[model samples]
Target: MKVEQNADLPKTTHCNKSRRNLTEEEKEARRIRRVLANRESARQTIRRRQ
Candidate 1:
C-alpha cells in the first residue's frame, strides 16, 4: 500500500459568518480598524507618488 501526504491542507472557516453575529461595538471596532488600515495605505501611496 502507498502512503498519502496531507501536508498542505486548506483551512475551512466560518469566522466571517460568526462575525456578522457580533454586537454593535465589535462591528464598530472592525470598521475603525479597517479605516485606520485604509488611511495608512493611502499615506504610503502618496509617499510613493512623491
Candidate 2:
C-alpha cells in the first residue's frame, strides 16, 4: 500500500480530482488546519534559518 507524506493530513490532499470538488471555504479551512497542525514544525524551520 502507498502511504502519504503527512499522517496527520487527510488522504484527499493527494487526490486532485477530489480536491477540485471542495468549495473555496473548505479549501481555506483545510489550509488553516494544515498550518495549525504544523505550528511546531514551522517554528523549527524558522529557527533553523536563523
Candidate 3:
C-alpha cells in the first residue's frame, strides 16, 4: 500500500554545451539590440495611438 518516492532527481542535461544558451559577447550584444528595438517600436505604436 506504500509507494516509494524517487530518491534521485531525473537528470535533465544536454550532451553538448552548444545546446545550452552559451552566448558570446556578439550574441549578447545582438540580443540587447533586439530588445531595444522592440521597446522603441512599442513606444512608437503607443504614440501613434494617442
Q: Ten consecutive residues with minimal summed lDDT in candidate 2?
A: 1-10
Task: Give the number of colliding residue pairs in candidate 1.
Answer: 0
Per-model TM against the reference:
0.61, 0.42, 0.52
Candidate 2 residue runs with Cα over 4 Å from true position: 1-8, 11-20, 41-50
lDDT of all predictions:
0.55, 0.65, 0.55
Q: Which candidate is the best by TM-score?
A: 1
Tens-place lDDT per residue, model 1, 1-50, is 22123212212354555444657896676666666666666777898999
**Candidate 2 residue 19 C-alpha distance from true site, Å:** 9.5
Candidate 3 steric clashes: 0
lDDT at position 38, candidate 3: 67
- For residues 1-50, what per-residue lDDT tens digits would candidate 3 score against the true structure? 22122212223354565565544985666666666666666777898999
Clashes of each: 0, 0, 0
